[model samples]
Target chain A: MKFLAEYRDPELAKQYLQEIKNTVTQPWSIMEVCGGQTHSLVKNGIIDMLPKEVTMIHGPGCPVCVTPLHLIDKAIHLALQENVILCSFGDMLRVPGSSKNLLEAKAEGGDVRILYSPLEAVQIAEANPSKEVVFFAVGFETTAPANALSVINAYRKGLKNYSILASHVLVPPAIECVMEDVDSHIDGFLAAGHVCTIMGNFEYYPLVEKYKVPIVVTGFEPLDVLQGILMVVRQLEAHKAEVENQYARIVKEEGNLEAQKMIFEVFEITDRLWRGMEIIPMSGYQVKEKYADFDATKKFKIEIEEAEENPECIAGEIMKGIKKPIECPEFGKKCKPTNPLGAPMVSSEGACAAYFHYSGLVEEY
Target chain B: MASKTKPVKMQLQCPMPKLDFDVITLGHGSGGVLTNKLLDSGVFDLLSNEVLDERHDGAFIEMNGKLAFSTDSFLVSPIFFPGGNIGELAVNGTVNDLAMCGAIPKYLSLSFIIEEGLKMTEFWEILTSIKFACEKAGVQVVTGDTKVVEKGKGDKIFINTSGIGTIHPKANINKNNIKIGDKIIVSGNIASHGMAIMSVREGLEFDSEIISDTTNLNTTIINLIEQFGANIHLLTDPTRGGVATVLKEIAMATEIGIDIFQKYLPIETQVDSACELLGLDPLYVANEGLFISFVEASIADDYLKYLQSDANGANAKLIGSVVNEHPKQVIMESAIGGKRVVSMLPGEQLPRIC
Candidate 1:
């Protein structure tokens, strides 16, 4: 509770809110590029408390929300195999694939287990020698180190029965994709703090220079987010675009070097198709050749197929900051958390779910 | 000489049967010697009362004019947790249910669905906890039944308890009685029982130990009912889906809106950290020992003071109030001065405190 309590201090949060109100001279739009930040903003009502000059857009920072439909299909297919034990983070259990979600597969006799860490999946593989255990390794750069280490640990132990269905995504490339979009009018960005904690703030400097947008690496607490907005507003008002660190306590300019080293050694950059957005160049990671034996897609011989996104879902536009969740016609009516039509509605960090969960007075906004 | 030594070694390894049987079998439910031995040595011996000792098929107890009957089944995994276990949970669950109805719980009927391979030592421990809980609640387990399922069919143990209590004549607690100006008072801290269970289940270790806030609320609830009577509009124990879900139910049932203030809601530091780590909202977490009461706004302050005087409701506070606006909705004024709807939980809460 050391860092948590300080960041949630009401008095401190008011100071930041007042600073942001004074800093903003004109209307500016900023996107928080992490689902965790999005949820915190909505749950704590930080979005509504911010000065009307600043509009907060939710980005596709949720790894579970951006995981492609085809990948979910492949995961479900692999989970249903007679001798396979599919392990995934709990959030992915309810994410609907084309035909069925992992939870449905579990109820239908698939050996699916919810694991907190990929290393736990490796342990399960060690315990159940006869069953092939595959972990659904999906997340942004924040989770890359842990997923990479699981494979490294498995190889060190010579765990042949263990593999991971990697859907690892990178934050920088996705940011570039958003900036490159012709219709995008984003003025600043709140970079995910945990992602910066792993990969460091060095990556955001290039994006700031390229897009001329102030990027503040932000934490997930209410005050952290308000303080982050203030930093962005100050930079924007002064007509200066630079990378700032509001979450300096946790994130450093040079992040965990050992973690970066481990990730690079096991993963290679590749073009990954986001669920709603177009494929961004080198926005995803694939298990390196040496670790191919530990990659579930290669081991299981899964055939990748092009799948169609539901036209009714505006998640792509929403992720790019072109549209808000409330703008979608199906937002609260046809689509909801219980019966999610898109990944954003299913993932806990997804912008749609956040809006839906905390949407009463928000309707007026 | 070797045979005699072998017998001695076997005796040393096996040890004495502190219980009649070392492990449970189907014969324990067959109404035979094994069944009698289990009851006589375990259940009846620990939970002995005049009514229970009578050994009748049904309990013939004397009750006043209005009686409240409620039953609940407990199947929480990792049966034993930091503050309590399935046995105490089973007893407290029904007792609280009856208390929510403004009844003073007096007698309970205990039943068990035990797995065949369960150890007698574990069963005895559970029985003992049940006895202690019954004594604390001032209720007696007058009659009971037991069934044995195969190893794979059941978890280690499951308990079902049905409680009967006398309802006070002045008590008129119901959702319909809730008025627009009613105040919502929550007893003690929220989200502790849920976070406690979740921490143990996920093997999460915090700086300080987080124990379940599972306790009997019969006495506290009865005392409040005696003092306030009809002024206490409604009472409910927030169990499966936390305070948010219970509030949603009340809103829908009465067609009134609920507005809760964020700063007033009492939450423990460790439970808050656990919830934050797991990306879970404390509002949606489960509670076992806590109850939320809707009381007349005029006497709400006095009622809160009375609740705070009791050890069980030491941290009690006025969390929210009933409103005519936003009918059938529960909203919270966030600490940051923003308002949002506190929706009911969608589905099962998954473990994610990684």
Candidate 2:
């Protein structure tokens, strides 16, 4: 409550909104590169309140929205197998795979459990010695430290039955890939605050310098988002492109050194494919060879076949900011939260789900 | 030929009760001595009244002309929660349902479907809670039934309550009466019941204990109807789907638009933090004791003041008002001046990694 109440203060938010309105001079498009920020913006109605000159484009910060279809299929395959207990975050339970989602598998008598943390999965493995326990590890850099520590803790305890289905993604490379697109009209960015809290703002300076884009590390609160937009607007108006910190209370320049070290010890950068988006170079982390025994893909001998996205879903274009969720013909009619045709419609932080859940405009579209 | 082997039995982990038979069995429902003992000593003794004491097949009672009849089943997991248990929930739930219909609940019929392996002490405890709740709500359990199933067939215990109440002649509380200018009033804090269950079920430890806001709303509702007759258009308890779902239901049912201001919504600090930590939205979290009222805008302030005078409605506030635009939709104006639709929850609220 200490941090939450102050950030949600209406008077303070009004001040930031006024500041953002006064700072903007011309039309500029900014992207919030975290699903949490996108959700806060939509839920709080900050998107509609912004100055008309500024456009807030949603980004690919939602890890659940970007997890490949094959990985979900593999997780479902492992979950339904005999003597295997599949532990995952609650968000992954409803995400549809190629054939079936994890919830369907669970209904069909799969031993699937929703865990708040990966460490709880390790504890489950310790308790059920006879059953193979696999944690569906997926998320951005903010989650890497915890997932990495789970493997480290398992190895330290010499737990043989524990492994993780790693789908860890990095934020910087994805930003770079977005910046490389010639059709993208992004002018600035609002970096995810929690990810910066873990990995620091050091990785973002290079992107800011190379792309000449102002990046403000922002928190997930109404006032924090308003202040973040104001900062980006000020930088854009002054023709300055630099990395600034709006969430200075939580994030630091160098990040958590110990967490970075632990992450390096457990995982290595590799080529990874985002669900609807094209494969970005060195955009994901794989369990290092030394921790191969803790890798679930190897431990379970999962053979993943190449899968294609639904031809009707425009989630790829939506993720790149080229199209909005409302622009898709099947948005609310065919693709909805209950029967999601794409990951964005299912994940809570996804742009499509955020728009569908919060904006009345979706009905008109 | 191989010899047939007897199946091994599983050892129950809980300590047995201090009774002749530690665990409940099918004999408890056989209408023999065990059934008589269970009724006379266990349930009837705790919840006794003149009608139930007559030992008749059904309760024969006199009621006023117009009556409201409603029934509900309680299948909440972990029958016991932080602030209350399923027994109190069952009573309050049915009582609130009747209250929502502008009726004063008077009599209730209680029934239970218990598992064979359940402990007698646990069953007694639940019965005691039901008695306490009925006494507080000024209702009597006039008739009831009990059945037992095999251990694997049921959970520990499940309760069903059917309530009958008298509706005030002047009260016309129905969704069809809602108009464009009607204002919406929420009773108190939201999302405590669902979060309390989640905290216990998921082993989520917070700095302070989050208890369920499970209490009877009949008295408060009756007071509102008595004071402001015909002005209150609709009364709905936001139970399963929280405030957002109830608002959507009203908007769609009446073909009216609802616009609620987020800043006026009352949510506890701890509930907000817990929801944030779990990636949950407080708007969609369930509340056991909260209800939303659609009243004429001219008298909405007076109604809010009247409600605020009551103990249960201390935190009552006017959250939103009906609108002509966006018919059949609910919109929320954010504190930062943004606007978005507050849609009904698609499924069970799950924690996200966003």
Candidate 3:
């Protein structure tokens, strides 16, 4: 109730909405990079609460939604490859890949499992020494620290059987991707609050200056989102692009140093493929070459082809916030939650999924 | 204005003895292994009637004609959410069960298990909600009872409601009619009610609000019965066990197999987001406002259309269908086109989700 009551502070939400309204000039589009933020914007009618000229578009903030279909297949392939236990969070189990997810792999006699944390993978590795245990590590910086801890724990314990199929995407590179969107035309960003809470707000300054887009680190609360939008609009109206924090109650400018230290200890910056977006430089985390023995893909020697988005899908444009899920011809017809033709439909916070679930027929205004 | 409600400590303090617990835990009532064990040992043995012995949330009997009966107790922790409350939940839950049998639900018996020392204002708001919900559902709480317990002995107000309705004479909806060609149709997205509760239960922050889709589905049931008649093979609302268990039950009961297309299932953004935060599977979560229709393939299109015509069924989708090949198994066709057997829950995934 403490959680619910605070966000529902009608008075606070109204105050934020008032501030946001005072900031917008002419028409402008701001994209919130985190799927969690996108969900909040749609669920609370935050968009409706905002100034009409200020359009908030969803960004590629969802890890599950952004995970490439081939990676899912690779995880499934490992699970089914005999004598392997594939572990992942519950969210990744139901996500549809090119042909199967972990759930299906489990059904096909694959040793697929759902674990609460990467530490559980270590536990399973310790408990079952004869068998190999692999965790499908997928998340942004917010989850990286805990996942990094798991690998470090496994290493400390000297558990040779434990490894990870890391699909960790980075926030800073993703923002840069938005900035470099050849045709995306994104003007600003409401940065995901939780990620900043762990990784800090410092990384976003370069993007703010390089792309000339206002970046505001905002919490997931309704009031937080409204206040964040207001901050971005104010920066845009004054042509003063900069990084600000509206969720300071939890997110600090420097973030959790301990978490950053732990994450850096285990992971190295690497190029990663986002499902519909191009592979960005140093946009992902991979187990450092020294920790390569704990990597699943390397352990299994998988040589699968890099996956391609369904050619019929306009998800690339959708992911850029230049278009909505419904804007794609394939969205409801050939692509949807039931049979997601792309990552956006599969991830819980994917823009396509949000648009499909809340307003199935599409919003007119 | 934002006001603090009493905090509910959901996570039990420090892990108790793995095999031992003081009170029934979430796992015990989770509809998983513990639930099965709880039922096998004595709970079901003591409370079951010949009809109730069917061991389902619902039952059908051939009284004079055909009759469907169901009872559910609402123990929602928060009691109130964005769209509705436990009072509305109780009414809608009962009505939906009766409608699941293609029954024109007419009467309900309400029973309240109240915890003493509860606030009068909360009681007033809840009762008013009951009146509003009953009126909207077009059903009356014809009989009722009230019981009070010691303050800490109970969890606020627990409500139990039983419903009775006459099945349409022309309607022959039953698992027996579930054939290979029958299609599986869901009324709306899965997990709205479950996530609506979880969003509040866990102190997770999101830039959004989750509203309960806690409404009666009698109208949708009524429309389906009117349009499809005998083509309607079966109908049931996947409440506590989510869509996964619902399909498994139908598969086991009918001695057939069911395939749910993962790509075709419905899920809301907020519900999905909340589920992600809590490590919950939306399919395994609960819902008070959804129903699954098992209609013959020939009429599946029409039934989907009929469902689509209604506001509640606007997000309705034709998932998988019934099949005699894989007997007693519920398999979901993953979005990637892989198939997995969706077995009945091994244990409760979440407690008090309803």
Candidate 4:
């Protein structure tokens, strides 16, 4: 509890809130480039406590929410096969694919399991030598190294039964997508601290310079988020655009070099489709040729046709900061956590879920 | 301030005696020689009492007044955990259910659906815990049944317990009794049981020694009712869906508003950290030994003082109150200073895909 309790201290959070209140001069829309940050802001009631001048826009940083529907369908397809056992992170099991989610598939006797790590899937393959084990590998850069390492470890152990259905997204392209959208009207950004901890803050420099937007690497804790907001507000007040690290305790300038090395060695950048957004170039990772045998899609010869999105879901606009979750017609009516129409409502870190679960009734208080 | 309470380690007295078989086979559940031998080995002697010694197919007991009957089934994997096992959980579950109805639990009927290949030693340990739990709750197991399934058809063991109790004389607990300005009090820390199970679960193992808060709440509730009488309007244990689900269900059922303050909710430090690490909301987690009581506003302070002095309710807190505004909703004022709607848990709280 050492790192957790200190950051959640109310007195310290109050100091940061006061500092942010005094630092801001005008209205500014600053986006947090991680769904985890959005969740923290909404869950801790930070969005309501912040100065009125600052508006925190949610980003498309939830890997589960952004994983393409077709890829999900493919994973489910593999799970339904007679001799395959599909494993995935817990959140992905609830996200809807085309007609059914992985949980639904599981209830229908599909062999679906929720695991914390991909390496565990590798071990499962080792234990059940006869059955093929497919791990639904999905995440941002923070998880890429581990996912990549699983494939490497599988190959080293000569685990032919082990393969990964990966759908990894990156943070920088998402920032660019948001900034490129002229309607987004963003001012600054709170970069995801955990992602930066893996890939480093170096990627944000060019974007900061180009967009003239301050990008502060932020942690998920309440104090870290408040301090990150205050740092961004100070920069916007002074018209300074630079990348700063508010979570320096865990994230360094260069990041974990060995993790990055493992990621690059096993995965190469590729064009990947975001669930509700257009395909951004070099925005995702795919298993390299050397590890292609460990890729589930390739191993199973899967080619799922692109599926259509729910027209009522405005997740793309919400992720781009062009619209708030409440702006959607089905905000909490047709779209709910129980019967979510989009992945945002299902994934724990999703912006829509953060809003729905923690939206404060300003009038009641 | 919420303080971390170490797990209470029960010193089990009786050891497993030597049996002819090391592992239970299909014949053990056949209701013949093997079944009789199995029961005679320990279950008969360990839980022996006047009512259970009758050994009839069903129990016939005398009741003077109104009685409450409740039943529950336990299917928790990893039956053995840090502080307790499924046996105690089964006993406490039925006992608490009956207690919530303002009843003093008396007779319980236990049943088991066990896998064919369970070890005899493990079953004896579970039976010992069950014996200990029944003694602590002041209840007797009058009748029971056992069945066995093949290895793949069942998780090690599943237990179902049903209990009958007499309603307390002064208690008039009802959801309709909930009124505006009523105070809501929790009888201990929250989320410890769920985190304890999560710590030892197969796939997502973390390096924490958190223990389950699985204990009987009958004694605590009976004492509170005896002292406070009709002042206690409602008593509910937050079991499957933590504090939020239980409160939300009450709010929706009675069309009353509930506003709880996050700071006033008591939780252990290690459990809080584990929840944070797993990206889980403690509100949506599960609890076993904790109960939330709705009492009259005037006696809230005195009730909390009395509860805090009890060993089982040492971490009791006045978390919130029934409100007139926002009817049919449960709202929580966060520790920092904002309020949000606390909804029923949609499904199991899954770990985040970060």
lDDT for each residue of candidate 2 in B21-75, tens digit (9 for 90 to 100): 6677888878899988778664776788999988799999999779999999998
What's the distance in Å from true for residue A169, model 3?
Answer: 1.2
What's the DockQ for every one of the candidates? 0.35, 0.45, 0.04, 0.44
The DockQ leader among the candidates is 2
The 10-residue segment of model 3 chain B with minimum total lDDT is B9-18
Worst 10 residues of 2 chain A by lDDT: A356-365
- Tens digits of per-residue lDDT, candidate 1, A1-365, equal 68777777888888888888888889999999999899889888888788899999888798888898989998998988999989898888888888789999988878788767888778878977898999999999988899999999999999889999999899999999999999888999999999999999998888888889999999888988998889899999999999999999999899989999999989999999998897889999999999999999889977757567778998899898889988899988878877888989887788888888887623311
Q: Could you tell me the TM-score of candidate 2? A: 0.94
Model 3 regions more than 4 Å off = A362-365, B1-66, B69-284, B287-354
Q: State the RMSD for candidate 3.
A: 15.4
True contacts kept of each: 0.49, 0.70, 0.00, 0.58
> What are the per-model C-alpha RMSD values against the true structure?
5.3, 4.9, 15.4, 3.8
Sort the candidates on TM-score, descending order: 4, 2, 1, 3
For candidate 1, the docking band is: acceptable
lDDT of 4 by residue, A261-310 (tens): 99999999998899988899889999999898998878888777778999
Candidate with more favorable, higher lDDT: 2 or 4: 4
Q: Residue by residue across A67-156, what tens digits does model 2's lDDT show?
A: 999999999999999889998988998998988899999888788888788988888788789988999999999899999999999999
Better of 1 and 4 by DockQ: 4
Candidate 2, residue A28: Cα displacement in angstroms equals 1.3
Q: Docking quality tier of candidate 4?
A: acceptable
User: What is the C-alpha local distance difference test score of each model?
Assistant: 0.86, 0.87, 0.74, 0.88
The per-residue C-alpha lDDT of model 4 at residue A66 equals 94
Q: How high is each candidate's TM-score?
A: 0.93, 0.94, 0.59, 0.95
Q: Which ten residues in a row have the lowest lDDT in candidate 1 chain B?
A: B1-10
